[model samples]
Target: MIRIMERIALDDDELHEDFMRSSGAGGQNVNKVETAVQLRFDVRGSPNLPEGVRGRLERLAGRRLTKDGVLVLTAQRFRTQERNRADALERLVEMVREAAVPPPPPRRPTRPTLGSKKRRLEGKRIRGDVKAMRGRVEGD
Candidate 1:
């Protein structure tokens, strides 16, 4: 089981991992070894996550999420498959941890204060007067 937060723990079975060949910097070993790890988690179908967390996870995943609400994370930063696998799982745990936090309250709409409004209008009037003074004098 993976603990995402104080209240959230995910079973190992919830995650699916696939290993594939890693590109770059491995030389001869890179072609023969499948060091890259791809981790998939079904956010929509998970029984472990709260509804709010599920929704936030989907939103935060963005392009990494599929239409079916599966989140795909790839980790290939390490040369060894074990390291990459751990990295992928770590990323998934971090994402779930982030999702566990409640979203901030929605911003309340507010109108400008009377004093601020008055100041804005006063500034505009001053700007207008300055521009008006640039015009040619009628009597000249």
Candidate 2:
């Protein structure tokens, strides 16, 4: 099970992982063993994610999500296949959790209070006076 958040958990079946060659630095063992993991998740068909969250994840994934609606991630940083697999799953879960939380609604616009407006005008006036003082005291 992939636990995303307190309430969100994805079943192992929902995740697809395949072993492949890693491009990163490694010895001959790297060439022989498929240590890289490619993980794909179908956000559009997942029963685990909420409708809104799935939509958001699809959008957040951008190019990662294919036209068929699969979020694809390649994990080749780790040396071992298991490690690479775990890394991919961890990253996917984290991203899902992040996308699960919706942004807070925007606050309504407000006009500056009368006092604040007055204070701002006064500050502008003071600045203008200070700048005016910088002018040359030429004409007698």
- The digit string of per-residue lDDT tens for model 2 on 51-115 reads 88998888889899899999999999878898888899888988898898998999999999999
Which tens-of-lDDT digit does each residue in 20-84 have in candidate 1? 99989999999999999999999999999999999999999999999999999999999999999
Deviation in Å, model 2, residue 78 alpha carbon: 1.3
**Candidate of highest TM-score:** 2
Q: Evaluate model 1: give its lDDT.
A: 0.93
Query: What total of clashing residue pairs does each candidate reach?
Result: 0, 0
Q: Which stretches of candidate 2 lie over 4 Å from their true place?
A: 135-140
The worst-scoring run of ten residues by lDDT in candidate 2 lies at 22-31
> How high is the CA lDDT of each candidate model?
0.93, 0.89
Candidate 1 lDDT score at position 82: 96
